[model samples]
Target chain A: EKWASTAPRIASTRLALHHFDTSYSLRLGALWPSVRAGLLCEQKYGALLNNFAAADHVPQELEPLNAADFVSEASQKAQQWQRGAAVGAVARGCQEGSGEGRTVMQAEMMAQAEMMAQAEMSPPLGASISSKIKCYTFPRGDITRFRPARPDSLGLLDYYLMDAASLLPVLALNVQPGDFVLDLCAAPGGKTLALLQTGFCGHLAANDISISRTKRLYQILHSYVPREVRDTVSVTSYDGRDWDQVKGGTFHKGAGAGSVLLQVLVDVPCTTDRHSATEEDNNIFHKRRTKERQMLPMLQLQLLMAGILAAKPGAEVVYSTCSLSPLQNECVVERALDIAEAQFNISIHVEDLSHFRTLFQETFSFFSDCRLGELVLPHLTANFGPMYFCKLRRM
Target chain B: RALLPARALPAGPGPCPRRGCGEAAALRAAGFSQEQARRLLALQPRLGPEQREAAAAQLLLLGLSAEAALALLERSPALLRLPTERLRERAEELRRLGLDGGRLERAVRRSPQLLHVPRKRLRAAVRLLRERCLFTAEQLREVLGTCPAVLQEEPRTLHHQFQYAYFRMGVQQKEMVKARLFQTPFAELRNRHIFLERRGLYETPHKGQTQISNPKLKDILQLPEEDFLASLAYSTPEEYEVFKKLLAREEEEKEEEDVDALYT
Candidate 1:
C-alpha cells in the first residue's frame, strides 16, 4: 500500500512546478515541451507497453517464427510505426503488395522495425555518459509485481525482482568482491538482494531502522537467497546515520587501522508518487509529503555524512532517493557533497556519474542541472522511475 | 510430436480425493475460476463438502459477501479447516474489539490471517492492551481498527510495547493510543527513544510539569529509524545499536534487582 513512485503523480508534480517564474522553474517549463514531445513519440512505438522476453531467452514458441516471418511482421508493424521510417519501401509495401527486390525490402523493413523498437526502449542520453557499465532500460515490474516467469530458475528468480531504476544505485556503489557493503536504509531490501546476487562479498550488513520492516527484509532474503549466502549477511535493526557503530567492530577486523566500509548504499526516504493511488492516499500522501519536505533533507544530509565517515579512504558511497522533489533529490546531494568535502575530505565525484548519466539519458529524460546527481523523470524517460542517485568517494 | 498432449502426461501424485464436485462447484458459484477452485481444494484437501459449506455459511452469517468469503478462503485455505465454533467465537471476539460490521469485514479482507489466530492468544492481547496498557475500550477499538496485527502479536510483545511507551518514554495512554504505538515493534521504539534520550535530544515527560524538550510521541514513533536518528536524535545508527544493547543490559540489571527485592 505504501507505493511511493508512480509515473502520473511525478508527471503532475513536475508539470505543476513549471508555473513558478524562477529560473529553475522556467528551465523546467522549457524542458516540459521536449519531455512531452519525447513521451508522445515513445508512446507511438508501442513496444514501450509490450512485455518483452530477454534478448537471449526468446520463448520456444516464438523461436519458430524465422527471420522472414519477423520481417513480414516488421512490415505489418512498420505500417503502424507513427513517423520517421514510414517512407518509400515500407509505405510502398503498405500501399502495394509486391514490389522489386522483395528480399532486400524485407531486410530494410526489419532493420527499421528494430530501430523503432530500440527508440521506444532506449531513448538517447546526451554525451555526458560513458558506455562502460551495463544499463538495462526496460522498466520491468515498476507498475506491478508481474515478472515474466522464465523457464530457467535463475532467470525467473532475478527477472524484474526490483524496479530497474533501483539497480543503478547499487551499480553506482561499485561493490567489489570481498567488499564490506552496508545498505543503510535496507528494508524490504531489493538493493541488498541485488548486491548479494551480483558479487561474492566478504560480508553484507543490511540494516533497516524499523524493526517490523527489518523483519520483512529478513523474510525477503531468507525466502530468495540460500541459507549459506543469507548467513554471510548480517541483518541489524539500527538507524542508518549511525553507520560507524555496527556491532562487534566486524568492519574493522579484516585489515589494519585503515579498514573501513568499502561501499555504502544511502537510499534515503522521500515523498513518493504512485500513479495508482486512491482518494484516501491523497490525504495521507499530502500530509506525509508536507512533513517529509520539512524533515527529510536534514536526515538525508546526516545519513550521507555518516556514510562518508563510515567509508575507508577512496571508498565509494552511493546516495539515492526514490523521489523527484529537487529538495530531497538534487539539493540534498549537493549539500551532502559540500558538507562531506568540508568536514571529512570526501571528494564528490561528478565523473563517477558520467557513465550513469549517459545510460540515464539513453534510457530516460536526463536533466543536466541536477548538479550532483542524475534525475530520472517518470514519463519523460521510461515508465518506471522518479528515482535520483549520485556517487562519491572518500578522499 | 514434440510436446506431450495434456492427457499423455501422468497424473500428479498429490491428487485430492474429491475433485470437480460440490465444494468446487460451490466455490465456482461463489466466483472462483476453475483453476482457483482446484488450487483451493489442493491446498487444503482435508476440507470436506460439509466443512466448506459450513465455512461459507458462517462467513455469510458474519456478513461477508460470497465474493469476500471466496477471496478470503482462496488467500488463506487454512481457514477452511478451522473449527466452526472457534471461527465463530473469534469473529464475535473481533466484533467486540470495535471492528464491528463493515470494519470487521474490511480488516479481514485486508489480512485474512486475522481469522486464523488462536482465541486465547487474541484475548490475552486484548487484555494486555486494556488492563496493563490502560487503553480505553474506544482506544483499544481504534488500535484494532488501524492494526489488527496487534491481536496476532504475542501478549508479552504487546506488554513490552506498552511498558516501553508508558514507563520508559513517559508517554501517557492517550498520547500512546493516538500515536498507534502498538503498530511498531517494541525493539524499534526502544532503540529510537534510547538513542534520543542518550543524545539529550529528547526528555521524558513528567506528570505535573510541561515537557518543553520532549518530542511528541507521534513524532517520535512516526519517523523511520534513520530519520529519527538524523533529525531528532542527531545520532548515528551504530551509536543507536550500541546504546540499544547497553539499555537492554541496564533493563536486565534492574529486573535482577527487582527479583532480589521480591526474594528478600
Candidate 2:
C-alpha cells in the first residue's frame, strides 16, 4: 500500500530501481550479477542478424554443419529450444578438425558446469577472438522467415535487421574498394545501412547531431540503400564537435595518404545497456540524471575527440560503444589517446581487434574485460550484445 | 522507417510523432527515457517566438538580457552543458561558440537552477570561486566551466577582480586560472599589472616559493600593448608613454591617500 506507508516514497522508488543495479554494479565489478546476466540474455532472446547485401552471390560456407547436422529433426527442435545450440554445435564441430572432438566436448563441458546450456552465448568464447564483419548471411541456413520488424515482410525486401554484433564496428573498417566512408554518429542509420551493403564505400558521409536524428538518418539511408550505393552518400547535420576532418575536409580531399582509405564510424553515445536495462525513460538512473550520469564519460570523450578530429591523416578509426562502462569503454580510449597527443597535434594507435575477437567467437560473447576495446557480452543463444569495439590508426 | 518496429519508435519529443510531448513528460519527470526524451528533444529545436527572439538576440552578445536571457532559460536548465570558452580550447572553445547558435547549448532550456532563488546568484559566484578565489573543486569546475561570465559580475565587482588577481598581483589559483585572468578588464588587468610593476620588470610571486621572472601570465594578460611593450616589458612605445603618465600619478595618489586617511 503506497510501498508500505511511503517511507520517503520507498527511498525514492528504490533510488530509481537501484539506479540500473547501482550503475553497472559500480561499473561492473564482479561483472554485475556474474558476466552481466549473460549479457542480458542476449538482449532478450536474440536474432537480429539480417545481412543479404543483395544476398551477395549467396554462399556462407555452403551449409556446413555435419556432426550428422546435430541429429536433425530441425536440430532437435533447435536443441529443444537450444540445448546450447547442441552444445554450441558440439563446439563448432570440435573446432572443425576434431582433436578428439575438443577433448570430448572439453570433458563434457567441464563435467556439466551445471547447464541452461551453461547460460548460453559463449563456448568459453572459443578460448577468446580467433579475430572479427561484413555484409550478409543466408544461402538459407541461419534461417529467416524474415521478421525483426518486417522490412516489408518480403517482396523486394533485401535485408538489414542488424546487431550481428552491430556488424563489428563496420567490419572493423576493412572497407577497401576505394574507401571514403565517415559514419560519425550517423543516426539510426544502421552503420550507414551496413556501409552501403559493402558495395564498397568509395564515398559516404552520413553524419548526425540530430536534426531529428538527421531525419532518421534519411529514413535509413533511403530505406536500406541501392540506387548506385544511394548515389555515393552525402547527408549531414554537423555539430559533432565541429566536424571538419582537416581544413574543409569531408571525403579524403585531393586524395593521397598512400592512395586514399579514410573510413571513420565512431559509434559513440553510451549507457544504452539495452536502453538502460529496459527503459525507465532516459533513465541514467534518474536521481534527476545525476549530472547527466557523471557527464557520460565526458560525452564519450568528446565524441572520441570528434572522431579523432575528423581524421584523414592515415585514417581508419572505429571506436564503438553500447557500453558496459569501463568509464564508457577503456576510459574513452584512454582519454582519447591523451587528447589525441596533447590537444590535436594528432597521433593514434590501438589496432589488434584480437583476430576481430577471434573472428566473432562463433557469433559473439567476447569480454577480455577490455583494455582498449572488444566487448560483445550478450548471451542465451548469441543475442547480439552489449557491444564495445575499438580500432584506430591515424598517425 | 526500415519498416518500423523496435516496439514502434515514434514515441515523439520532436515533431510530435503521436503526442507524448510536454517535453516528453518533462523529460520523463527529469530522468529522461522516451529514448533520452527523444535525444533530449532532438537537442532542443522548439524555439520560435522568432527563434526565442533570435535566441534573445544571441544572448545579447553574451552579456545576457533579452528578458534576462529568457529568464535564464526559465531558470537554469543546467546552463545547458556550460563550457563557454574560458575552459580554453575545448575543440577551440566549441569552434568559437559555434558561431552564435551556441552559447554552449543555445542559451538554456529549463533544468533546475538548484530549485530556484536564481541559484542565489550562481551560489554566490560559486562561493566566490571557492572562498575568495582559491578555486579547486576541480578549479571551481574549470572556473564555472571556463568563466560562466563570473555570473554577471557585481559581488563587489567579483571582489574587485579576485582582489587584483589575488592580492596585488602575487598571482596564483594557478596563474589566475591559467591566465584567463577574468578575461582581462579589471581595468585592463590593472593596466598590465602596473605596467610590469613600473618596468623593474615585475616580481610579486612571493610567499617563499621564490621566483618571479614574471611575464608569461599569458604574456602579461594576453599580449598586445605593442606586445606588452616589446616582448613583455623589455619596454617601449616611448617607455609605454612614460609609464601611462607615471601610472596616472600613482592612481591620483591612491585616491588622495583614501581622502587623507578619511579626514585625519
lDDT per residue (tens digit) for residues B142-259 in model 2 = 5544555665455678888887777776677877777777666787777677666533356566573534366667678887788776676655464345345445555777899999
Write candidate 2's Cα lDDT for A251-356 as tens digits.
Answer: 4453445566677888887767665554555556556666887887887788778777777777788888876767788888888999889887788878766644
DockQ of each: 0.01, 0.00
lDDT of 1 by residue, B1-264 (tens): 465565553453133344546677787776666655555565555567678767767887777876687788878888888888888998998897789988788889888899888778888888988888778998888888877888889888778778878777777888887787877777678766655553334556657353346788888889887887677665556445545554566677789999999999
> Model 1, DockQ value?
0.01
Best by TM-score: 1
Off by over 4 Å in 1: A1-27, A32-160, A246-249, A254-261, A275-284, A345-350, A360-362, B1-264
- Docking model 1 quality class: incorrect
- Residue A5, model 2, lDDT: 52
Q: lDDT of all predictions, in order shown? A: 0.61, 0.57
Per-residue lDDT for A1-395 in model 1, tens only?
45565424543333323222233234455444323222222121111111122324432323342211111232233334425343644555574566676778778777666455533343331211212222223331121123342433432232333455666677566666577887888998877776775544668888888898888898767555666787888888888777677642556564235443567788886654332121233332443355655687899888877777776777788888866567777788788778877876667664345434433443445566776677665442244455688877766
